[model samples]
Target: MTSPAVPRQPLLDDAIIALHAPTQAWSGRDGDIGDAAIDGIYHGDIRHIRSVRIRVADSSIETISRSIIDAATVEFGSVLRGLDDDGADPKVRLIRHRALSAGVMTEHLGLHSHRDVPLSVAVTVEVAPEFAPMQDVKAGLAATEPWHAEAIAASDGTPGRIEVRSSDGHRSFVVEAAGAAATVADTIVLRWDIELDPRSVVEIGWSATLTDDTLVVAAAANSEIAVPSTDDPRLARWVEQATRDLAALRLVLPDHPEDAFYAAGAPWFFTLFGRDSLWAARLALATDPGIAASTLRVLARLQGTKTDPATAEQPGKILHELRSAPLSLPNEGVHLPPLYYGTVDATPLWVCLLADARDAGMPEAEVRELVPALRAALTWITDFGSGTGSGFLDYVDETGHGLANQGWKDSGDSIQWRDGRLAEGPIALCEVQAYAYEAAVRGAQLLDDLGEGGGDELREWAAVLRDRFRDAFWVTTPEGRYPAIALDAHGAAVDSLTSNIGHLIGTGILDANEERACADLLLGASMSSGFGIRTLSLGAAGFWPLSYHGGSVWAHDTAVAVHGMLRSGLLAEAREVAGQLVDAAEGFAYRMPELHSGDSHDAVPFPTPYPASCRPQAWSAAAAIVCAEAYAAAP
Candidate 1:
């Protein structure tokens, strides 16, 4: 059997592959379509999709491919079969043709499952003359039955197979849509099972389908959520913008373990920051819990061990950020990140996550299994983490490429002296202690589930950490009082009263009064920037709204504050920060970026995206999960 010479495939039978109007919602939309946004990078080449259509028996299937990628040149079409895809009744269209522009990658775009018709799509491509693409990556290749047949390995009489590999050097997907044998320049076809499903989220998926020729091929599915009906034009536009942002946020997995995670955008942020990745995975959790689980596993596998010069990597340590690029180092030459580990707060936070997993009802055994890692993390604090040979956890990067202030805020002026002079390296930031305290407290819960000495050991660790932190970091002055942000290697206080000190409230390290005072400072006029709490007080000499960690408002950071407020029962204060942050996000398109500058509401004529920052950063994504809890708590 052979597939008929089909003439062109329409994206939708009658619908246009058009852009969202200026004022339109991306998701949860109403009947009306808004203005068109031309700036977007559709993965498929404009050359390929413009007036290109293939006739398929099923109307639900849609095929969009890109000539730019050497990986699977042929891609599957999503089937729009669910009630949500089409309106009340069916309106089909072999639709689409995107407006092209230069540097399209800068903006965001993705495949649209825009109809409710079912389809079985296949792709055919000619392999590079020299190499035979691997067919093993395809789903259900070489099988019988419509459900069973996806992609089958086939070779041209000349040479090679068809399989797609990612920029990170990892294979993506492969499938056979046609014949068992072929000649030079013969097409390698890959087919898909479903045309589209409204439930399709832009998550990883595999499917199979039968074609006209009984060809088997494996394929991957890419689906984006769209709002069906909406009243407000700006709201509609904002939703579409958000959906585009969601597509751009997809993380690029590397070919090998030692590679980096690169954001496919300007500032081209490419690193392996544990908190960031976990946070990003948190965003995708509702759509795919598997991603979150994989994130936990991957990060847990690399959990820090014994302080090394380059990273100061410690056992059971959750890394702050690991990179694989060459940057300006004090004396180092051009060296790629190759997994630079220079984070302090990642360790305790890792322990805290395990506790969260347990709280989220993860299995006791799964939680207990990571005890060795947790114990190692605790040991790290007493060992290499105490860079000053002091009991508290201090950070000193062995690598110049590594950050000096190794906690979340690794910027230079992030920590300061009481008089406002920036502190030097080998410092123990207060959040690490707070995170450690929280970890210990959470560890007690996890350990008690395991067996003997859990409660006693956890209690002992918490008590020591709590007492030492309270005494050592506490500060007092005639004007104001709060916990210190960090201590110099020599043990003098970097006495600047900043948000870092307030972070302690998040870890449950502060007493009731301390927590209340901390919450007050965050919401008080000195710190609250109307947009949200400034990273440091406005009165502080080192305060800089756009400063990386110095003053930028991180949604995740605020999320932590919200958690702290909730823990301390400061509902009003927490809601103040949480509500403002969410409302701020609503103004921006409902999509949160890595971080934003902390300026007064009127300071900027318009909100500015963080320069050289990663948009759709992982931690920023997870911040919403925590934020949702906070929003629901609002009363």
Candidate 2:
């Protein structure tokens, strides 16, 4: 069999126009013409507008500078130059300001003339709507089918307003221009003519509104939650960026318009995710428990109700992810059904999030109402999660097309033995057991506090599981004793030293001595990249600094380890790791991506950006928040 191809970097430049608000977002390179390969406006997982190009006198303009003002605003400055009558340079500068909110994008363009003569310029904005699925767009594929567009006749006898309707009639948007001579030149082009005298400027305003009532209503009701500030400037900036990014990522579910939960990430995974949302919400609990509350409620409502192998759904199991459109990778034979429940950890993580939210001051009445869901989730852990009577939370892909490794490290090659061979079916990940143990203990406490019985049974189960995990998973390496990454189908320990053991800390699955050993290993050279903890150790057989999950340093993973260490009383180690994360965030302009290269910090002064890593990732953004909270609470 052919070896799997390594992931490739995006062809688009890093400098791009990206503005997002929950379910709607637009990302494209900073060019006069939008590249169909990587530029589009997406809504509900569908690409509504594929290409947007701005032309002046039939020539594409070159960008001089670009700046992102906030989550919703970006500004680009470009210049159009042509020889004057004297054959000298006559620079014509164009300033484009774009803002997004409520699924609407408004652009303001200003033309400035530098020469001492009047210049008449004909500017046109070309747009195309593909209505393509977001999955294909992210994969850098062109639209497979054509989407027809028809210009809407100007209403109120005004030519400044232009609207386009999709062929299917399910989607439509309007573009309006003001303070310039504007008209529809073609089915997909809007033209503006303006005359600017020497040293004078003429400005035009353009607005594109996606006619979605649900998005409009949600935007109006959404309010920003304030993140606490600290004396440390770096930490403060990290917190601010994380807070803004989280707010931008918040999407209002169609069923629950009043409440909001964060979509997974931008460019891809921008939808309700069972594990990612639960973890992001949990990390932000100290700032606002409402996020966790809403996320739990939404996931509870969507919990699996029956056995469906195609989508990997099982009764009482939390969903892995939900997408509005079915995704089929081109020629890859991998088709993702709308709903997936192959995750073994999300159910326990859901219970843990409930407990964390309650501790973070979620209202009692709301907590009480979720008791039934909590019980159902616990039942899932006891029944389906402990596959084959292994006394451990494990997972095996029921469908051949489903994810092979269903933990947070869901990539196919993520779970491997020390000798670099892939682990087989019914694999038991170490962190999944930690999550299960934590869920049981925390769930028992929540139940007892709420005057509900059955706490004793859960506590006993947790105790037994913890002891069994310690006996079965722990293995001594050359460096020290740490939990194996996972157990293979043959019940042999997959002895790859990885960041998975760090997750066991503070989860109550490991004893004090074991937690200390794990902490030491985390801070040691094998695991620590001086930027963040690598997913796998450097000495491991399959270690690849740039690999997606094999050795890349994930911000959220580092944050989790830091938080765990802090809770386990490893103050020095916690501070060191947290400080490294803050430094890495600075290297990424305070907007940390999903993961970065695991190159040694001494070898590379800055965190290496993982090609195609999601920026403003839900968990990555929340990592700063989690670290900030830990710093503030440190004694």
Q: How many clashes (backbone N, Cα, C below 3 Å) per candidate?
A: 67, 0
lDDT of 1 by residue, 154-264 (tens): 555422233432333321323222322323222223222333454232221211110111111111123243332344343344334444443333342333332222122
Mark the 10 consecutive residues where model 2 has the least summed lDDT: 212-221
Cand. 1 Cα-lDDT: 0.49
lDDT of 2 by residue, 1-635 (tens): 99976433244326354546544444454544355355666665666777677778944577778877777777888877651345455467889887777668778888887778888888877766566666666655656344444344466665666566565566667767664454443336667777778888888767777753323214315648678778789989888888888888887677677778887877676678888988888877777678899889989988988888888787889998876556666534457787778789999999999988888888999999999999989888887787768888888877677777889998888998777888887899999999999999999999999999888999999999988887889887775678999988888889899998888898988878888889888888989998889999987889999998999999999988877887788777787888889889999888888899999998999988886787778899898877886677666
Of the candidates shown, which would achieve the greatest TM-score relative to the real structure? 2
| Residue 454 Cα positional deviation in candidate 2, in Å, after optimal superposition | 0.9
Candidate 2 Cα outliers beyond 4 Å, as residue runs: 1-17, 22-33, 58-60, 83-91, 160-162, 179-187, 211-220, 330-332
Q: Which run of 10 residues does model 1 get worst, by summed lDDT? A: 21-30
